[model samples]
Target chain A: MLYDVFISPFAEFEFMRRALIGSFALTIGAAPIGVFLMLRRMSLVGDAMAHAILPGAAVGYLISGLSLAAMTAGGLVAGCLVAILAGVVTRNTLLREDASLASFYIISLAAGVTLVSLRGSNIDLLHVLFGSVLALDDDTLLLLAWIATITLLVLAVMFRPLLLECVDPGFLRSVSRGGTVTHLVFLCLVVVNLVGGFHAMGTLLAVGMLMLPAIAARFWCAGVGPMIAAAAFIGALASISGLLVSYHAGLATGPTIILSAGVLYIFSLLVGPHGGLVRQWAPGRHLEA
Target chain B: MTFALRFSDLTLGYERHPAIHHLTGEVPAGDLLAVCGPNGAGKSTLLKGIVGILSPLDGTIERVGVGPREIAYLPQAADIDRSFPVTVYELVSTGLLREAGLFGRIGRGERTRIEDAIAAVGLTGFEGRSIGTLSGGQMQRMLFARLLLQDSPVILLDEPFTAIDDKTTSDLLGLIGRWHSEKRTVIAVLHDFEVVRKHFPRTLLLAREKVAWDATQNALNGENLLKARRMVEAFDTAAHACERAA
Candidate 1:
């Protein structure tokens, strides 16, 4: 009975193993990018970029019968376009950064819904929204591994610039000539990671996982290197816990992962030493006091 | 002590419209020179150009004490993003970057210097506190702490005394005096004639074109003061221009 119920559902399953590997890779690879996003206060951009992939994935699926390949390509194209447009508008106009992001998200949503409707997908599109852990296959798992490698490589190359830019852009400009190029490259990596994470975590959960763990890590860390490491650890833990819960309880995986990350975020928000909620619960929330 | 800075035919502007045209100036070492100018006279631009924050359209800016790796830049407190949740220690550690050299590690020696910088700025135990919670005075002091950590021979300050209480301003002024005594060349972009006369032995009076790049406050006569006042007022007016119109 135990074999039929618990062990068999998890151990005896190939799809489960693929899903496990994909989830682990996504969690490990995408977390450091989240720390930067939170530091830059551009968590909303991650959300918009995640959702921006939907129309691309939908359109690709509509045109081609292949599921994972078409969606990834389509998502990348859509996300990059939206991100560039947002960046240009923000740079050109006097509008605040948040306002520009909001405008871009609105446009991307409109475009995605229009295209998705055109694709005439009557099937459960939870893979794009909530993500399907069970649907992961050997091929998709291999692609996810590549995604992890590329994400880590891009992050490792741009890590210094990304941290500097996030902490003090003026200092970066004052220091080196390559600052502009490095910053643009980092943003491109952000777009790619958002797209890569979308397959397992879904748009909402991808953003949630990216931001929550990093925000939580801020309370525990003194320096940039430690913060990045802490954020990655938090992400990996949440992803593992989420997958385990999803497997044992027969619940959805994406929301479960996000919930775990979000819970950690709340813990940090409330109990963190520096910016923690419980610490700042009083008027002493003001750092000076 | 030798000459601190030399700007040779330095022209600076944004995109197309030139702000300061063909300006040449030099400062002797150990002198606090207040750069006073009329609004749109490019005082900030000049500061930016000399300090290598903003590249000049033409010509060169060379400084003696400021090596290729050493500089202490105190940007206007308002210009910094105070809303960020970084701790005082984290913010101050950035000053060590010049010595740490981007990818270089922050060793024990660097850590020791960071503590000294914080103490120099009179905020020793406040390292754990978040930067966002500091008052305007405390915030400026934190900036000073960071500058102290840089340990550079030349310090470039852009309107450090703006929008603060008289007490804080005067306290900072006294700190500047102590800094000057250390023989570091200090270039302060300021408006108050009283502070300039009391602190700076040299003055650079500018009006888009270089009007006076001479020594002593005596050069800042009534006419120069009038032009400087106009420029400073115009800048003060232009900043909130949108609200003033409404």
Candidate 2:
């Protein structure tokens, strides 16, 4: 039974193995960015940016007929443009960043759906809205791996300034000229990660991997470092378990993985030691200072 | 005397409404100055202008001896988000950003300095604690520790002592005294006239416009204090743009 649960699914099928690797790669890069997004109070911004990439990918579909390279590039360009445009509007107008981003992403989503329907069948729209992770080709796998690599390297270089930006942006501004550059770099990483995530999980549910694990990690860890580590760990665990369960039960791959993450989030909310419901409700004793 | 900072017809504000009006002044190097004013007196705005956070709406502020990096700023405690998951050690270590630029390693020597700064502020045992756990006084002490590690030639503080306990206030004032003796140019926004009279030598008495810029004893005179209040009350909130040419 144990072998059937764990080993048989992967051993029996090449596509399952590819899906596993692809989702794992998506998790590794996206989780840390998710933690930062939560810290910055921009959790929903990730969801918005995910939706923002859809229209671009749709346009790419119209042009190249389901080409991975064209869709990714198109998504990157669209995501960045929306992020920048929303930032500009927030600065110039009365609208806050969140409101401006919400407006743009809604428009982008409608545009994407319209553009996709104009040229493709309902099945094609389904493929775009909910990705076929059971069929990740070699090129898509390579793209996921490269995205993970670039995210990790860029984050390593930008970690300190990014942390400073979250904790005390005014202090960062006083010390160096790198504050704006650091902020722009962070926004770029978010867009890059979301565009990559859209390929594996589709635009609709791609942010599930990005936001859920990070939100769950907040309950489990205290420091930023631990929180990010816990997020990545939770994401990997959910990816493996979700992929295996979906294989055994004849379930859709992407939604199953996201549901697994959601279950983990609920579990953390109930029992995590840091700020979980149990810890908040039950106090045994106070420690000596 | 060499000026540490010079303001020339400087106006700073938000949305084209001037907070600090056309004021011109020069602060000599190594001067321990107190910026004393009533509420909405543009005291904080002037400090921001000096720190280069807000550009002038009209004229210029020239730093004579110090660069932007050499000025350490302590913003009001209310401005910081206390719930961020950073340890005291991490927060204090950011003070060395000047020596250790982005991506530079924090060497053994730097680590020692961070510890010493924490110890200097009586936060030695609290290094592992998150900023969320600190009390208001402890948080102020922690910020003072960061300023200690900054080791800047010029320091700007905005309402640094508000809501802090007496012990912490005295402790931080002692640190400021040490900075003054070491020839650092220190400027602070203060509400307590007694503290200002006892500590700061030079004073800039302001109410959107310069009321008196002289010795603390003379600047805090009854006439000037009353005039500052009147000037703030007389400020035009809905007036059109200044008719004076830039």
Candidate 3:
């Protein structure tokens, strides 16, 4: 039963193998970015950015139909534009970040949906919206791997300043010029990962791989470092399990993967160590001196 | 004598409406100065200008010897997001950001310095504890520890004792006294007049403009204090923008 559930799928199907590899790449590249978004209180902003990239992806599709490179470039540009627009509006105008992001993302989503529908049929729209993990070519796989590598490397380089910027921006400003640079670089990283995820699992569910795993890990860990590691592990685990479930049950791959992450999140919320419902509800835990 | 900070006809504010209007002063190097003023008197704004967080609307703030990295600033506790996930040690280690930077290695000596700063702030054995678990006093102590690690020549404190207990305040004041003895230039925005009169020898009194900048005795005089209050109270919130002379 176990062999049939997991091993046979990978051993028999080339598409399943490719899908698993692609999901792993997405997990490594995108999940840690999600952790930062959560820490910065920009989880929803990450989601908004995913939608904001759809118009870009659609534009990419319009320019070169189903061309991975073109779609990725388009998504990158649109995502960055929204990120910068939201940042500018928040800083200069009376509108707060959430309000500004909401305004931009909704407009971007509408534009994206409109653009995709303009040229493509319903099947093409579904492909753009739901992603085709099974249909990923070698180039797409390579792109995912490169994004994961760059995201991890850039994040590693910017780790210290990024932490300071997140925790105490005023102190960072007092000490170095890296604060603003760190912020811009972080936004770029977010956009890069979102574009990558958009290719792997559609615009709508791309953020799920990023956010859900990080949030679930947050329930289990106290420190940022631990939380990041735990989130990556959860993301990887969810990807594998989600792939297995999709293979055996004949389910949609993208939603199943995100739903796998969602299940972990729910489980962690109930039973994981840090601030879990069980921990909170346990007798005498709070009263301890 | 070189001035650590020199503010010449400085105007600082939000939206071109000066919160501090045409203020001018010099802080002598190594002097401990207290910035005292009524509410909205722009004490915090002056500090922000010195720390380079806020640019002057007009004129200049000249620092003779100190560069941006050589001045350590402590903002109000309210401005910090205490819920952030960081250990006390990790937060304190960030004081070395100017030295180690983004990818710089923290050698044994640097690590020891961090440990010493944590110890100096009375946060020994809290090396592994998350910052979110710290009490208000502990958080303030951790901030002081970080400042100690900064080891800068100029220190700016914004209401460092506002919310902490008296014991923590006194403990931190001792650290300040040590900085004074070491001849570090220290400027603090203080609301407690009694604390200022007692510890700080110099004071700059403000009321959207310079009211007094002298010894604490002279700056805190009853008449000057009353005048500052009235000036702050009577200032028009809906006043027209001042035209630049060009």
Model 2: share of real contacts kept: 0.68
* Over 4 Å off, model 2: A91-94, A113-123, B234-238, B244-246
Poorly placed runs, candidate 3 (over 4 Å) = A113-123, A283-289, B234-238, B241-246
lDDT (tens digit, per residue) of candidate 1 on B1-246: 368888888888766445777788678787788988766788888877766766787778887856533566766543455555568888888776656654687878888888888887778888988777788778888888787777777888889988778877887788788879998788898878788888888888888767777765565888766765654322232232122110
Docking outcome class, model 2: medium
At residue A160, give the lDDT of candidate 2.
87
Q: Provide the overall lDDT of each model, using Cα atoms, as 2-decimal numbers.
A: 0.73, 0.88, 0.87
Number of the top candidate by DockQ?
3
In model 2 chain A, where is the ten-residue run with the lowest total lDDT?
A119-128
The CAPRI class of candidate 3 is medium
- Per model, state how many residue pairs clash: 5, 0, 0
**lDDT pick, better of 1 and 3:** 3
lDDT score for residue B195 of model 3: 91
True contacts kept of each: 0.09, 0.68, 0.79
TM-score of each: 0.78, 0.96, 0.95
Supply the TM-score for candidate 3.
0.95
